[model samples]
Target: MLAAATAAVLLLFLVALVMMAAAAFAFAVLMLMAVP
Candidate 1:
């Protein structure tokens, strides 16, 4: 039970990290387009 809980938490963390990275990448693209 403890292992399952830990796995769930780790999975959630990884998903959040991926989402943040994708957001950053998109923001960078937008900034580059706006510059010129």
Candidate 2:
């Protein structure tokens, strides 16, 4: 039961990380567009 809970937390963390990475990439693109 503990293992399952830990796995769930890790999965959520991974999802959050991916979302943050995607957001960062989008922000960078927007910044670049603004510069030009």
What TM-score does model 2 achieve against the real structure?
0.95
Alpha-carbon local distance difference test for all models? 1.00, 0.99
- Tell me the spans in candidate 1 whose CA falls farther than 4 Å from its real position: none
Record all residue pairs in model 1 with backbone atoms less than 3 Å apart, i.e. clashing: none
Judging by TM-score against the true structure, name the best candidate: 1
TM-score of each: 0.98, 0.95
Superposed on all Cα atoms, the candidates' RMSDs to the truth, in angstroms, are 0.2, 0.4
For 1-36, candidate 2 gives per-residue lDDT tens digits of 999999999999999999999999999999999997
Error of 2 at 19 (Å): 0.3
